[model samples]
Target: MQLEKDSKLELNDRSRQIGDVITDVESKVRKKYETHFQEQEDKIAELQRQLNLVSARSRRPKRGRKGKEV
Candidate 1:
């Protein structure tokens, strides 16, 4: 009976260790993905800004077109 109890304790300890390792790996992966997503978001924002600049320029009438009658 004592040997069985000892084996059970060892098994429980190993399980706890594995669980801790899994949790740590999960945390690292989540952080990495968050960083990746943030970088992508920043790139998208930059592209949007550039698009807005181009759009603003395109919407204005050119000086040459003003002298011509519609």
Candidate 2:
């Protein structure tokens, strides 16, 4: 009857609201994780660059005393 129809409509509205809230929360979580991953990647890249510079410098001979003629 009419009462049953009204109940169904109310249930549908509540379900829709719950779905919207879930979607919003999921979007926020994804954004936070994406930012965290990007920061980690940037840190790794910076560390790699510093390691390369140190390795390159170490491979070269010293200039003043080491390079002097015997």
Candidate 3:
């Protein structure tokens, strides 16, 4: 009976350790994904800004039929 109790305790301890490891791994993975998403969002925002600047610079004033400013 004593040996059986000891075995059970050891198994419980190992299970707890595994659970802790899983939790830690999950936390790390979530942090990594969050960082990657934030980087992608920053890149997209920068590209949008650049596109707006380019489009704004490409606009031209309209002219009349004689080529004079309307």
Which candidate tops TM-score? 2
lDDT (tens digit, per residue) of candidate 2 on 1-70? 0123345567777677678778888999999999999999999999999999999998887677778634
Q: lDDT scores for all predictions? A: 0.79, 0.80, 0.80
Candidate ranking under TM-score, highest first, comes to 2, 1, 3
Which parts of model 2 have CA positions greater than 4 angstroms off?
1-9, 65-70
What does candidate 1's lDDT look like per residue over 1-70, in tens digits?
0123345567777677678778888999999999999999999999999999999998876555657534
Badly placed stretches (over 4 Å) of model 3 are: 1-9, 62-70
Q: What does candidate 3's lDDT look like per residue over 1-70, in tens digits?
A: 0123345567777677678778888999999999999999999999999999988877866679999977
Tell me how candidate 1 scores on lDDT.
Answer: 0.79
Ten contiguous residues with the weakest lDDT in model 2: 1-10
Tally clashing residue pairs in candidate 3: 0
Candidate 3 lDDT trough over 10 residues, lowest sum: 1-10
